[model samples]
Target: MINLPMSAPTFIKSAEIYRSLRKKGITIRKTIDCLIAVLCLEHEVRLFRNDHDFLFIAEHFPLRIV
Candidate 1:
């Protein structure tokens, strides 16, 4: 188990990601998913998720989805 910190910059980045997705006509069902995606992106870690929303986020960001 690991504890990932969410700082002000991370939260700002998450909101930017959400806004970017929205601009592309993609609507993420949950805000937490955006936060998680930002964390993975910041840490350079691949995210393993079954949620379809991630596909959209992955497309816009450099998020590695496995």
Candidate 2:
């Protein structure tokens, strides 16, 4: 597995984002999708996923999907 230094701010921000998204009725899988988005943004790396939401976010965000 790829390792990343889990910063305090990143963890807090990710949790906040996840909670807000869950409150909006997004699925757990979607919350993970958003987490992956945060990771990709922080690392400046591309993500390969078949999840539709992942693709959607990747389209609008600075992610290269493959």
Candidate 3:
């Protein structure tokens, strides 16, 4: 398991991601999910998730869903 730390840029990116999704009419029930997506994006880490929320995020961002 990797321990990834959330930084200021991560938070900023997460907000951007959340707002972008909202503008696109995609509402992620959990805000934390966006943060998680940003983490994977910024780190170039592929996410293994079954949550549908990740699907929306992956559609826009370079978040690879494995």
TM-score of 2: 0.62
Q: What tens digits encode model 3's per-residue C-alpha lDDT throughout 36-61? A: 99888878898999899999998888
TM per prediction: 0.93, 0.62, 0.93
- Give the higher-TM-score candidate: 2 or 3: 3
As for candidate 1, its clashing pairs are none
Model 3, residue 64: C-alpha shift (Å) = 0.4
Locate the minimum summed-lDDT window of 10 residues in model 3: 38-47
Q: Give the alpha carbon lDDT tens digit for every residue of 1-66 in model 2.
A: 677666777767667656665566654465666767777778877777777876556544566777
Off by over 4 Å in 1: none
Instruction: Give the local distance difference test score of model 3.
Output: 0.91
lDDT of 1: 0.91
lDDT against the true structure, per candidate, is: 0.91, 0.67, 0.91
Regions of model 3 farther than 4 Å from truth: none
The all-Cα superposition gives candidate 1 an RMSD in Å to the true structure of 0.9
Report the lDDT tens digits of candidate 1 across residue range 1-66: 557888999999999999989988899999889999999988888899999989999888889999
